[model samples]
Target: MDTVITVTGEQSANDLGVTLPHEHLIIDASIWVPDGPELTAIQRRKLEESVSMENLWWLAAYGRQPKWNSLDNRRLDDVETAKREAMRFVAEGGETLVDVTPMSPGLGRDPGALKRIANHTGLNVVAGTGHYVRHAHPPRIDDQSASEIADEMVGDIVDGIDGTGVRAGVIGEIGATNGFSDHPNEKTVFRAAAIAQQRTGAPITIHPPVHYKEGHDVLDVLEEAGANLTNVILGHLDGAMELDNASAYYDSLAERGVSLEFDTFGRIGYIASEDVCFPLDETRIRELRRLFDKGYGDQLLVSHDICKKNQLTKYAGHGYDYILRDIVPRLRRREFSETEITSLLVDNPARALTIEE
Candidate 1:
């Protein structure tokens, strides 16, 4: 099967050069709001009430539901803005932007959207397929068989989604929550992703449930699925980078010829703010040196997993700019050779996203 699907004349993965293995142009959790007629007042209130939580003082604590306009900046679906952002990143030396927007419940699927954005932005955009986790999957997925899910994913890759000619270049951000042992859905999702990888030959990237035990479980599933471990990437390892855990994860995956991705570089306060950590200062440099010493440097890929629209508000002050400006120079100051730094930013990612013609 042909892995590359052209949309709006942009080249596919095989043509994308110096790719950032993980990143997004536009993404919204609200995109998962099921499509239908507008919700009634009573129904809307009931839905809001269910997600509302109470604090110790009995104050209603609502989770930060993103202000759709605020989070997306009203330009996510706009081609002009996407073009500017992509051009800026490319001008700054980025070649490809891997959109890991997996197929999930409530999230509207638009495989052709990337093609439109890429055509406007002049950035090589690679879209993804495969279901997320149980929380993100439509309720009906709970009762579906593994083969059923796998077949659906294969359809997304082989058959163009929504009757659009665009097809997925990758198979994840497959969500694995907690340990794979206890969670049946995580295992199911993993199995489905593995099947997608085997069928498509596109690289698979896993969003492991946690940073440790569950992460190992994801690797186990990928191995069993016959995914070319060399082409797989274990993402979100930065959350574990503070300790020797990053080394352990990288070394384990490296031994299997897989890549290790540390993409949450600039997203300091979002997502796992309390639990998520960055290896900046001497700590980051030391870790890089340690990985290089262990012969694992070639497998490391770095980026800022900026998913929110607010993240891209400023050109040079946001997104990958944070890493290219702040982090890269700091690593150099700490005696990380320019050659090594280039390999991490340019070479390693290029290899990870590269697919044979």
Candidate 2:
């Protein structure tokens, strides 16, 4: 049987149950959250406010404003907090979670922390390898060739990350922005991730910029690098619902043999920077039903993509179990059969994470 690498160790791929293909437990993606304009004294204080029931709505409601979307809100650094939140999913029948936080100092991918979470919660935690978007990448990246980057990532996959002996099961949540026009470094990372994926046969999951029809653009780069499409997953497809001819766009993407992850399950709001508004969960469910009807059900995956502190139940947001505790019932009410749901939450993730030997 093919094995899937987790933070603790390797496991039989078939043993990975009800997996969330996209999530972040111990991450600091604050680098991705852009700095806001000059802040007033009072505004700065509000931005630094600890997430609470009184301010949770304000945090979510002002998501469009970078100042209001505080850097403090974007980070999940507390191991115990992550464990407590993740255990909620374990109680709700989740067996595995893929923490696709990109491997970089700026993003702070902590393999040791992941190991602790797995040990504590008994949640098989699969980590990723690769750099994020240009902003998060170190300055040395500009001097490094794609081959050198691939060498580092392949080492992480085959040997381990930062000498932790915790091999990465996935190659991404590799980041890109506005289809690589703004950040050429993303192209290099894409090529490097593709090379690493080809070397290890590990699945590559992409974090495409919100609302860009870069699905094929991204695949083209990977294909040029001889990456296997069967082992690729493009994340945040829920953000594509607003595109013109969205269903047909999905049909073309499905034909390429790459899985599409409709993550961002619980987030609903506007993003001013991208001018993209996250659709309601009902809209995502409706789009999912449409995709299923078009026979693309097998190509689908789902997750809450919980990375922010406000997203934790401790802050009055939907916790890690949102999909199981809420979305599953909603899907059932929408007439989605158990088999389809199982494929989304279980079989697809197992297959996606399995190393090709």
- Please list the C-alpha lDDT of all candidates, in the order they appear: 0.64, 0.87
Error of 1 at 112 (Å): 2.7
- State which candidate has the highest TM-score: 2
Q: Give per-model TM-scores.
A: 0.78, 0.96
Report model 2's TM-score to 2 decimal places. Answer: 0.96
The lDDT of model 2 is 0.87
**lDDT (Cα, tens digit) per residue for candidate 1, span 160-268:** 6656767777777787766467888778777877777777666788777534535667778777866678878888776666645566766766687778777777643
The residue pairs found clashing in candidate 1 are 32-106, 32-107, 83-121, 176-209, 177-209
Model 2 agreement with the true structure over 1-357: per-residue lDDT tens digits: 889999888999999999999999988867755445677675677766766677777887884466666677888999999999999999999999999997877787999999999999999999998988777888889889889999999999899999989889899888887747556678888999988887888899999876878888888888898899889999998888877888788889999999989999998877775677788999999988988899988889999889888889998789999999999999899899999999989988888888887
Q: What local lDDT does model 2 show for residue 128?
A: 93
The local lDDT score (0 to 100) that residue 44 gets in candidate 2 is: 75
Off by over 4 Å in 2: 36-43
